[model samples]
Target chain A: MQVTVTTRTRSSSIAGYAAIALIVIGLALPAFASRSLIQDLFFILTMLTLAQLWNLIAGYGGMVSVGQQAFVGIGAYAMFAGVILWGMDPVPAILLGGVAGFLLAIPMAFFAFRLQGAYFAIGTWVIAEVTRLIIAQWKTLGGGTGTSLPREATSDIMGVEAIAQLFGLRDAAARDVLAYWLALLLAVGTMAAIYALLRSRTGLALAAVRDNDNAAQSVGVDARRVKWMVFLAAATMTGLVGALIYVQTARISPDAAFSVTTWTAYVIFIAVIGGIGRLEGPILGVLVFWGLQTAFSDYGSWYLLALGLIAIAVMLLAPRGLWGLIADRWGIALFPVQRRLILEGTRHG
Target chain B: MIWLDTVVQGVLLGGLYALFAAGLSLVFGIMRLVNLAHGDLIVASAFLILIVVETLGLNPFLAALVAAPALFALGWALQRFVLNRVLGKDILPPLLVTFGLSVALQNGMLELFSADSQRIAAGPLESASIDLGIVTVGTMPLLTFASAVLVIFLLNRLFYSTALGRAFRATSDDAVTASLMGINPKSVFAIATGLAMVIVTIAALYLGMRANFDPSVGPARLIYAFEAVIIGGLGSLWGTLIGGAIIGVAQTVGAQLNPEWQILAGHLAFLVVLILRPRGLFPRAVD
Candidate 1:
């Protein structure tokens, strides 16, 4: 019997429908869920978006960066500038975060791209620090201190009124709902973009580069261009998510905005433990992380200690991560993008 | 005279930065493992010294003597048990594991020590300065610089003139080949990390005495160490000293211009160095 290749699998199709159902439920979540629950989901969605961006760059692109907070802080600050300085609507300002990130990424990539392996990680971190220190000097944004969204800006934010009327909720709750919706839209859009990209020819090139750069070059994959593309795209999405995160908080400061521990380290923890190099990994990682945080957050440093231990254990025991372990055991591919061969004369299904 | 003083002060400050970067360079050169927890380990060392000083009523120097060996053991255990497993073809495991370690170390220090910044009381040395005709220097800064020089000198001797150093170099060149020649790569790595931790102990002593330190200060210290290492070249010890001096001078000069520009100036110098020499000012021949 001859073999035929296909990207689709029964499980993948099921996962696609499952994802659609999730989106629909997510859209209606604000209706029945409490304001706090909506707020919590906003955190999850934004964090999921951040984790996915990190997975794309580090996991798939093979560029490990510990300084993604650079984009996050810059994006947040840009959004703040858009709303506070230029009097733009918050919705459009969020998009400006992505633009600002993209703009900043050119110079950053030029500098950081010069280094390889571990140095690249530190190089990005140093740039992030410089960015934070420079941002702290802008007196218009409260300088070293920080500033919150103006009363008029937060009160009259776009879509808040409509959301309030539709849900019969108060202004504050409406703002939360609106931010939640934007976060949902952004997360869904990011996942879809990543999904579509991974299925394209460029995705094949990315996988090739990740597996082996020299071999990819030997095969004419243009590794450098692909890396630059992945880096810039990750930065833009991270910036957007960073902006949305601050929009929900309605305040911005250099420390809070550019915190490496909060913005970068935690994201790494999620992606690594959930599984790197898989679309399902970050989703699994975030839920586990969030669950761990909710359960043991009261213990303070012990919570972080446990996280460190778990990450190390997973790295040693199952470097492929939790989802990887499950996939290996059950032969499941929830979002299988890789091609596989089947005997043409046989009906495996 | 003012400019001379500024330059001299910057050099002394660079001594401290060099001390911080030395351990980092040693480990990276040997294993190619960038310890993300490095700055936190420095902070953790400071806490170890502090505990000895506070509880035993010993001076910081004596406390450091006690803390160094303890940290050596910790480093050795960490490398042998934790870091060695993650050191392989893929770079992500080491980076992620160390990143997690950084998080854990910082938070653990916070829980143990609280967030309050602490200083090691250096008695009369804290304010003592000596007058030179052109530039006056603080006694502490001078001692720190001397200690830094001594540490580098000793490290150089150990690396270049010792049998253990030979094993280190050989293992670093090719682990499998070194193993074939009767060296244990794992033990060599553990010893290298142990040695690095001793340097961290010295850096921690000055770091505590020089400024107020809390648990969260580790990452910032790490940045300075990283910048120095990059400016100097990744694997060169002497290069780290010069890089540290450059940063120290830039920061002092920037502070002279405007206080806010001090940190930014050091980073700018690093960036300029990076642009001019991507491999660093003194890149090793092998790389």
Candidate 2:
């Protein structure tokens, strides 16, 4: 008799093949897709990135933050500062945004970490608002009004010309293509990084801490360090996404940059609705969210109201999310992170 | 003399912030549920009062009397039906549910009110003021301050002196044990929320009178209330008032130094306080 441990399923392998095919098609999309379609894909990819980072912190790390916009805003600002102030290339400046997010997380964690549960959520929001207010006073960055990326920074960005030459596209189209490629890379990179992390030892520690901090601590999990690391990593990734988003838009404003509705609320909705704590959930969630937007956004506030109602209904009825439902019913996990032991012959030792 | 006037005015302004926090503090203290929709609910109550005022053409205060009970019923039903189900060990469900509620309420109000900032139009009461010996005070601010005090006092009375209050304390202390004593924690929670809604009505009345309110103003108001509750220490009613005053003074003082610093200064103070006292200034002794 033999026992075997595995994290893979037959469906998972099929899902992997499907994923490779999807990537192949995605890479070729620019050749056939309309500009608007490319742009919409960009939106979906960026949103999916944001949702994944948020899911990591809240779902696995047990820190429900309502102030993630703080990082997004800061990251966007940092990228702008990098290009405008230091004359750094726009692409390199985005990495700076991640660093800025990491730096900002220190003080944020300092204040927010003291509080527990719901207070932590509100505390983060307050800090974000405060950050917005302070940034609004900076006369250098267009103050409260915000500013656009300089033409030199946007048009003459590193690799724009090369990308244009390679794609045989004009300048504007080239920039869009470049941004689209970056978005694709970011989306894929973020998902792969998170998936890899979840399969690692630290990921197990994170789950343990999330389930019961005191108990995990008794088991020597170092819950504080785990939480700190998770917060920092999420902040850094969120910042990178934020910077990348604004780089594509080429404009920034404090209010727009720090918008809770866009950066935090929508991401939370995506993660929660799609099935939080699961790697595949945010992807499905973003698609559904985008679908809802396209189908019903013409109704304006009613659409938002509907989104809210759906979110509430999901939280109450299916706390595990839509994918959770499918997973439970079908026993399918495209990106299975949970470990399962199989008894080959069930022999007595 | 100017400094004295500013401090006094800030203290009066603190009363309004305290009013905003009272219901929030009460609900949080009893249930351990942070109602993300709390600020939106306050804004919604303001709208409810506006509808009553417009339809009946009654005085806003008189309208508040009508709005309060209606809001109380709304709160009761919300807690009994919606919130109570999500309550228990896992904190995420209530937080997310309330967040959804907040978004729905905001957009719903926006749809109904059309993003317009509306006021209660108190007729001379909006601008009327009385000269104290050292500083002049607006009639509305004074009334707001007095009402905040009265609300807190009544709440304290209810929380400490009544059988219902006893039930609240018992449930809050240990819901399982309290249930063994034949008390229905769900009803207690519903009643507590109803009481909180009444306070929210009071806060909404002054908010509409003293300032313009639109659907989107709820989250900001929630921030102010949260800061006050945290500064005062969780579950400490009187501490909330002092916390509100602290934020109020910080804002005013910052405004005096540089107008742009007003909101920033208040938040800085909150951070400083948080750094100094992680659990809040007056945290409850037990979890």
Candidate 3:
């Protein structure tokens, strides 16, 4: 951190504050906007959160996990169990889903951690499929058909609609607005957490592991444990976002829950296009991706094909991704994680 | 008596799965690339055989022979031009690109063939069967099983007994180092994919004869293939054979107990294998 904290930096801080304010305004927009528009925005933000979580693991950590959807599925099924069966409240139940997903990830982390590189990707996918098969026949949890979340789980708090109203989010005219606001908050929180985590000692170790596992382990870094922890963390975050996705939609099914489609294709596309290693890459990737999806939604598989073509083009032309290229060319540091020495020379405190 | 018949049918059915897994194993063993598009490539070859069969009115085997060379060329070009570029230090690039290719192929096939499921009409031979006292098995299945064994045997011979196969092993061990030893890494990969495509053509022949296939069937077939590979281990070719047998047996046995268990039982066996030996039953020394 530059100790001088330039006027430009101050202005940027103010810009961030303004951005938060705009989100707060958006949260209260239920009183103003159309129902459908808000709903679409909600979906976008939810997807943004999911993509961002993936970006952290695969992009920054350099752990390309094709099976984050497993955590997502676990999260959704956890919601089903917590809200539908255990009678937990909606908000708390979502948290429970996250926790359950974390617990599941821990054991999975132990097993899957043994596999390196592409093998790990396959391990994660296989684990997700196994979980799907188990839950598909559980009978109590809706089997392959799926089960519904009680509206009470996601609706008003303590039996009153006003509870949602208190946070400047009312579902009556704008469930989309409420959903958007929630997604915004989650996305921001995820960003902040990633930012903070990346700045930590362990984060440096994780980065080192990504650069070269043997090199990282040479100096007493337990690369395996660090990788496992990162995997678990990724699983937990993915699970939380997944719970939010299903909670917003109010339903869960084995196919939809465990759909690897929901996780990899877009996230990988977004992360790559936006530039993988940087924090801002996924954000840029999501906006561009959703924009394309919005435009090409009607073309069905053609849209998917276009996405694939673009990903291939990107990999060939600009492997560093969009924002990554920007960061390299412009020497810009929006969310700077690297240490830079100050001219002041007194530690810039 | 009927139970014995079903079991025999299941054993033969497992043979087809073994065929599916064989090509997949060859590719994976030589090049660690997963080839997410493998199933589609299989289907695509089947369509090629179908077209040749219809066009020349040639026998199905001759059509396959005609198509195999063309498929080999196509696969060689794909590996050389596209896949070879992405094979490097990071595995994700190949995975992502292949996944993209998978999507593209599925869409392309849908556009050309429509969504209708198809089977190559193998004419009267499809109904031909051999009865061995306790039970009878379709000629196609018997041929499929025999061919699977033959394919595996040939692959083994190639791997253990040939100069080209030795070059393949050497390349798999270390691409750069092998380059120092006069092996062209790119050509090796291209030939390997080409060889795998020949195997893919074999798989397509059996798949077209025995089951309905559309573009989407590739992914499901991929799942079975993947399960077989995992059950067998990462790199050992022979392990893939046993893996195919286990899945085939599990599914058939499960179906014998109850029909719904066909798919589920195989999945359960996969899970059981993973729990017991995450490295698979016969993990390769290197992997």
Candidate 4:
């Protein structure tokens, strides 16, 4: 008798094909989609990226940071500084956001990691608040009021001209297209990177650490290192998404950039409602979030109230989220990480 | 002389922060549940007091007394119905649920009250002050400090001298063993939360009178309370008071240097404390 270890299931294989098709459609979306549609897609993709990274740290790494806005806000500010201060193009400036996020994560992790469990969440939130207050002091960036990207910076972004000509659209619309493409690329890349990481040896260590830190440490997993790595990676990706978001708006305010409700709470809702600790969860969650926003956004605070209620209900009733419910019922895994032992050529011993 | 005045003001401010933190500290000590919605609950309690004062034409303090029992019921129901179910080994559910509740409460208040800042009108009492020779203090602040001390003192008495306090300690130490001894952990938790809400009502009275607040201010309040709790050390009530004072002093001193550094200074002090003493100044919990 022979046995094989495989992570893939029959359903997951089909999901792979479906995912490829979806990516194709997403890439071609700007070609035919209206400007508003592209803008909406941009919102979805960027949020999906944020949700995915958040899920990675909280869901997988067991570090539930409520201060992700720190990374996002810093990343956006870094990109703005890169363009306004350093004379860099906005496209290249996005990478600066990633760098800034990575740098901030070092000190943030150092401070926040001391506190365990729920206290950790509060620690991160404090750091984010400090970051916002400090950033508000930057007089060059319009101080507390915030500043907009120079008109030329927005119009002359690297790919905007090419995209404008290729799609036969105006600069503003073309900028949207460019930002949408970046967002789409980021979303896809994040999903792929997370999938690849989860399938790696380090990913196994991460899961082990999350399940039981003491037990995993007993089995020789460097839990601290794994957590730090996950935190840094998540922060970097979050920073990139933050920069991209501000670039799309072309306006950066300390309040808006570092908003807990917009950056952290909403991302958490998407991750939790779609499902935590699952890669496919954020994808589905972002879609659901976008749908809710489109339908109920006009109601103002009531919309937020509804979102909060829904999140609470989901946490209470469906702790595993919508995807968890579906997966349990159907035994389907679009992004299966469970290793199954398959027995082949069974013979009488 | 100027520094002494700033320090004095900071101590008084710390009393407000301690009021904000005492309920949080109590709930955490009893159940090991970090109520993320705590700040919003304080805000909500304030709004409730405001409504009571406006409708009944009562003093703010009297309105808080009227509002306290109702808040106690709300907190009791909240724990008995919502939070109790999520309390367990995995910290994710309680954290997420409370966070959701916080958002919901904030938005609900926003929907009802609008974004405009509102304050509880205290008439001349709001502006009345007392001379201390060296440094004068506002009557409201002086009262707030006295209330904070009284609340902590009473809470200590409730914790050490009462049967319910024994149950809280037992449950907090080991829920399973406490349950084996015929204590209903769930009911105990509900009562603890109810008590916490009573403290919150007191905090709310001072908070509403101290400054104008909108729905958005709840998170900042939560941060201040959290900082106090962390600075004091987990499960230590006196530690929480000291922690609050530290933050208050930091903010006042920072503001003296530069107005913009006020909140930032408090947070920086927290971070510095965390770095120097990760276990906090008076950590009681072994874990």
Q: Is candidate 1 or candidate 3 better by TM-score?
A: 1
Q: On residues B1-287, what C-alpha lDDT tens digit does candidate 3 reach at each position?
A: 87777767766776777788887787777778888778878888888888898889988888999999999999899889888888887887888787777767777777778789888888888899888877888898888878888888898899879999888888878789999999999999999999989999999988987888887777667777877887888667678777887888788888889775677788778768877887788977465
Per-residue lDDT for A28-111 in model 2, tens only?
888877778888999999999999999999998999999999999999999999998899889889998899899999999988
Best candidate according to DockQ: 4
The per-residue C-alpha lDDT of model 3 at residue B19 equals 80
Docking class of 2: high
Tell me each candidate's TM-score: 0.98, 0.97, 0.89, 0.98
TM-score of chain B, candidates 1 onward in order = 0.98, 0.98, 0.95, 0.99
lDDT of 1 by residue, B224-283 (tens): 888888888866888998899999999999899899999999999999999999888997
Per-prediction tally of clashes: 0, 0, 2, 1
Candidate 3 per-residue lDDT, tens place, A1-59, comes to 33542223433466467768877777666566666777777766777777777777776
Q: What's the fnat for candidate 4, on a 0 to 1 scale?
A: 0.81
The runs of at least 3 residues in candidate 3 whose Cα sits more than 4 Å from the true structure, single-residue gaps closed, are A1-22, A25-32, A87-89, A149-160, A163-173, A345-349, B1-11, B47-62, B111-115, B124-128, B274-285
> Model 3 chain A — which ten-residue stretch has the worst lDDT?
A2-11
What would the TM-score be for candidate 3 when compared with the true structure?
0.89
Segments of candidate 1 deviating more than 4 angstroms: A1-3
In model 4, which residue pairs have backbone atoms overlapping below 3 Å?
B232-B239
- Better TM-score candidate (2, 4): 4
Error of 3 at A133 (Å): 1.6
